[model samples]
Target: MLCIEVLVEEPSAEAALKSLLPKLLGSRARHKIINFGSKSKLLKVLGQRLAAYAARINKGENLRIIVLVDRDQDDCQDLKNKLEVIAVQAGLTTKSNPDAQGQFMVVNRIVIEELESWFIGDIQALRRSFSSLPSISPTSSPFRNPDNGGSWEALHRFLKKHGIYKSSYPKIEAARKIASQMNINENRSPSFQCFKAGIEALLSQENENLN
Candidate 1:
């Protein structure tokens, strides 16, 4: 059986993935979510965590590790390179640098700007979660590209304009609700699509191993 270990930077992400991963992994694979409380804390401890996973893999564990972080204000390429370097330092192959057979034990994905970009990417999912929200056109200004900066703030403002989360956005609650309605196949966020693609690749590799 294939087991996936997902490392996320915050509770909201954990909440969102909790609702989404079961739908993605199905009965063919099992997954565990590890929330690191904050992005700073996660980065501080990431090296140690990856080292531990490398040790487990050396013991012949059928485990795959996924590290997810928000791009926030960081340069995307630099952030990705940092993650790849960490995995290599831990003696594990990353998706960015696969082995000769094209197999990798780790995948690093960034939520472009922030997790709320995913909510902004899928207007239908947002409407499903918050029924009172007016239909938003994907061609509209900010909604057109959900990967833009200030994603959570943009989402909060949009929701507040609709009288939902009028005071403040509840990160975890909104994440769970919006993610539950998200169509993995239909999200418009490029980052979200990349994330979904990474999971699909992991599953594909697992199937190849089984064969």
Candidate 2:
């Protein structure tokens, strides 16, 4: 079984990803994420800290440990540090090009921090993407079981909860909400499938318009 380990700061984001990431990536298990309470990055954390965390996992060698980020609160430099810390701590072997003073195959994501402002740059969306769970409602459950319906539905629900879908009319998330409200989940939420799809669609549309 393929496995993915994720270190994130937003519970909702993790939940959103959990709903459809496995399906989208054809993963065997949902990506396991670690959302630290105080906003520590991969670099801020120590090797011992990472060892402690990674050791507490069920997934083995065929695992992809990815850290999803929003990068709202962290500076770019800060984000870089955090990613470095992740590899140093996870006990994942890294080959050092001692001459250049850098290690090879260090895992992390710095794109989120840069995309934070464009994505939402707010508390609700930030928390959702980073692994912070606000008060969940009775109508919506946060735990995602792909075996049930996959992430297509769960991510749609999350967008509504955080107001990401409603705020932008005719946007991907908004379109998804409309489709979901009408019970359409056969192929990627009728809009794109997941947030990632919506993003891709928008980018492609923009590129087409540019050309």
Candidate 3:
């Protein structure tokens, strides 16, 4: 079986994935999440982490790494290129630059704006998580493209408007709740879809290896 090691920048992303990965991987794969406390910290030590993983892979361990970080005002392509460079420096093949056989040991995904964008993408999931919240049209402004700027603020405002999270948003709590109810297939966020695609690609590779 393939063991997936997912590295995320913060606790909320870890909380969200805890509920969502099971729905995606099922019995086909084993996975673990490693939270780096903050995006700055994660980026600071990412090279060393990937280098360690590369050493393990060289020792014949069957492992794949997935790095997830929020875009948060950064140039998206530039951030991606930075991650790709780190992986290459660590001697690991990334999804962006696969080997001759089209196999890679790492995938780097950026959550556009923030993780809450995914919650906004699936309005039904948000409603299911917080029943008191009113319905939001998928085509509504700002929310129509959940990947737009100020996504977390947008979500928090809507939640507060409905008397939920009246003070500050408890990110981990909201992520756990909303993500548990999220239908991966129904999410409209392009970045979320990209994340799903990365997982699917890894699973597909595992299946091909078994064959």
Per-candidate clashes, comma-separated: 0, 21, 0
**Overall local distance difference test of candidate 3:** 0.94
- Model 3, 49-166: lDDT tens per residue? 9999999999999899999999999999999999999999999999999999999999999999899999989988988998887768878865789998798898898888889999
What is the per-residue lDDT of model 2 for residues 132-202, given as tens digits with 9 covering 90 to 100? 34654333343222213323344446656666444432333432223222211332111223334423332
Superposed by TM-score, candidate 3 places the C-alpha of residue 81 at a distance from the truth, in angstroms, of 0.1
Error of 3 at 87 (Å): 0.1
lDDT of 3 at 15: 100
**What's the residue-level lDDT of 100 in candidate 3?**
96
Q: What TM-score goes with each of the models?
A: 0.98, 0.42, 0.98
TM-score of decoy 1: 0.98
lDDT of 1 by residue, 84-121 (tens): 99899988998889999999999999999999999999
Q: Candidate 2: misplaced stretches above 4 Å?
A: 27-30, 41-49, 53-61, 94-106, 114-211
- Scored by lDDT, model 2 comes in at 0.40
Query: What is the lDDT ranking, best to worst?
Result: 3, 1, 2
Off by over 4 Å in 3: none
